[model samples]
Target: MLDIGIIGASGYTGGELMRLLLSHPQARVELATSRRLMGQKVSATHTHLKDMVDIQFENPDPHEIKDRCDVVFVAVPHGTAMNIVPKILDDKVKVIDLSADYRLKPAVFEDVYGIKHLDPRNVVYGMPELHPEIKHEGFIANPGCFPTGATLAAAPLAQASMIDSVVFDSKTGVSGAGIEPSQASHYPNMAENVQPYKLTKHRHLPEFTQELQRLDKNLTNISFTPHIIPSVRGILTTAHIFTKGTLTKYDVMDLYTEMYQDKPFVRMMDGIPSLSAVKGSNFCDIGFEVDPRNNRVVVISAIDNLVKGASGQAIQNMNIMCGLDETTGLWVPGIAP
Candidate 1:
């Protein structure tokens, strides 16, 4: 069994990783690190894993972590993973970073995040559907939650060179904001309201654009706007893909089917996908409609922001890198009511 270590284990993503890894037959949670929560039980912050995880939070140096874990998941904040990753990543240890640290080019990451990238290296972008090369690597940069849903929603058309321009309007749960309580995540403000922030220049926009552009170099017009919904855990993205030509629904469906045929986590739906269909699961449910008159295709995708978007995707990368079935611990139904 693979010995797993999770850095920044006090946050939502780290907790979610522990929750999912609990069921993996080939993996075990060997270490869970949280500086402040050191010596405390992991179940304290992650109440959902109360009876499931019996491990205590420990804050060992990054160097020591590399010795203990066969695989390490860096689930820290945006700029923090760079620090821990450089210390823990070695030939013996594979790393999957759940941060924005290594997803983009060093220059692009610096420009978008407005922080100097301390450690920059080329690593496979962790969208297994797009980058099959991840299976050959020891390091992976897990895509941002918004980009996970938005990019998957429109990737097939982009690969077919059918997109002229695309606009992604994504609704995400408060959990995407992180476990920390903020003015935006404040119960009163978030309840019975929808707050749209970073209208045109959200940071995740670059990631979505970068992934889609890789499919078709000439495809350039990509815009993304993210909103925080009143829900607790899921991202529902609506993509308005203005195509270069008029296509029927069957034509679009064919593209999605061909692209996602071998992908176990992507579910193509006949009707629009809903958050309930993907909540609490690693699946990304996608569906689209054709607007022939306007030469447009409206696509929608749903994913658990914390699952397919973050921790779950990190684990998916692990399975691929380890040569295990990609769905080893992740092939389960969503908690739809």
Candidate 2:
């Protein structure tokens, strides 16, 4: 069994990592660290895991952490994980960063986040369906929530070099904001309302561009806009893909089917995907419709922002890195109504 350690375990993503790891047969959470909440119970902030996780938060030395855990998940925020990751990372312990720090190239990360990267090590972009090379890497940079859904929605077409340009519009739940309640996530302001932020230049846009561009170098015309919805746990992305040529519905479906046939977590649906169908699960349910008149293929993808979008995806990467099936501990259905 692999002993797991989660650094910065006082937030939404950290709580999620603890919750999911509880059911993993080959994994055990040995450490959950939080500087501010040191010595406090993990379930104090993550009440949902009250009875499930009995461990208290502790501030452990990074070097000591490396020796205690076989796998370490850096669940800290941007600019913060960089401080912790380099200390705990070693050949014997695999590191998976659930932050924006290692996802982009050093220059790009500095440009987007406006924070200098102290440690600029090469790591696999851990989107299992897209990067099979993840299985061979010891360090993984987990994809951002918005980029995860948005990139997957357009990957098949991008890979086939059929896309002329694409616009990604995403609606995300409040949990994506984090555990801290902000003015935008405030109940009065966010309730019965949809707020769109960072319209033209969201940070995650670069990730979407980077991943898709890897498949097709010419696939550069990508636009993304994200909105905050009233709900609390999922992200649904609508990709308006302007294809190079006319594509019949059957033709579009065939391409997607062929691309994701072996990918267990990506579920291609006959109808449009819904957040309710994929909520609380580590699955990206995708569907598409071709609008022949406009030569636009609208692809929709749904995923739990905290699961497939963050922690669960981290676990998925861990499984692949450890030579286990990608779906080993995450092959459950979403919580549906």
Q: If scored against the real structure, what TM-score would every candidate get?
A: 0.99, 0.99
The Cα error of candidate 1 at residue 167, in Å, is 0.5
Model 2, stretches more than 4 Å misplaced? none
Error of 1 at 325 (Å): 0.4
Candidate 2: lDDT of 101?
A: 94
Per-residue error (Å), model 1, residue 141 = 0.2
For residue 143, model 1's alpha carbon misses the true position, in angstroms, by 0.5
**What TM-score does candidate 1 get on C-alpha atoms?**
0.99
Each prediction's whole-model lDDT (CA): 0.93, 0.93
Q: Taking the candidates one at a time, how many backbone clashes does each contain? A: 0, 0
Q: Which whole-number lDDT from 0 to 100 does residue 61 have in model 1?
A: 84
Q: Write the per-residue lDDT of candidate 2 for residues 1-337, one digit (tens) a residue.
A: 9999999889999999998999899999999999899999888888999988999999988788988999999988799888888887778999999999999999999999999999987778999999999988889999999999999999999999999999999999999999998999999999999999999999999999999999999988999999999999999999999999999998898899999999999999989999999988999999998999999999999999999999999999999999998888898899997
Model 1, 108-138: lDDT tens digits are 9999999998987887899999999999999
Error of 2 at 210 (Å): 0.4
Which residue runs does candidate 1 get wrong by more than 4 Å?
none
Model 2 / residue 103 / CA error / Å: 0.4
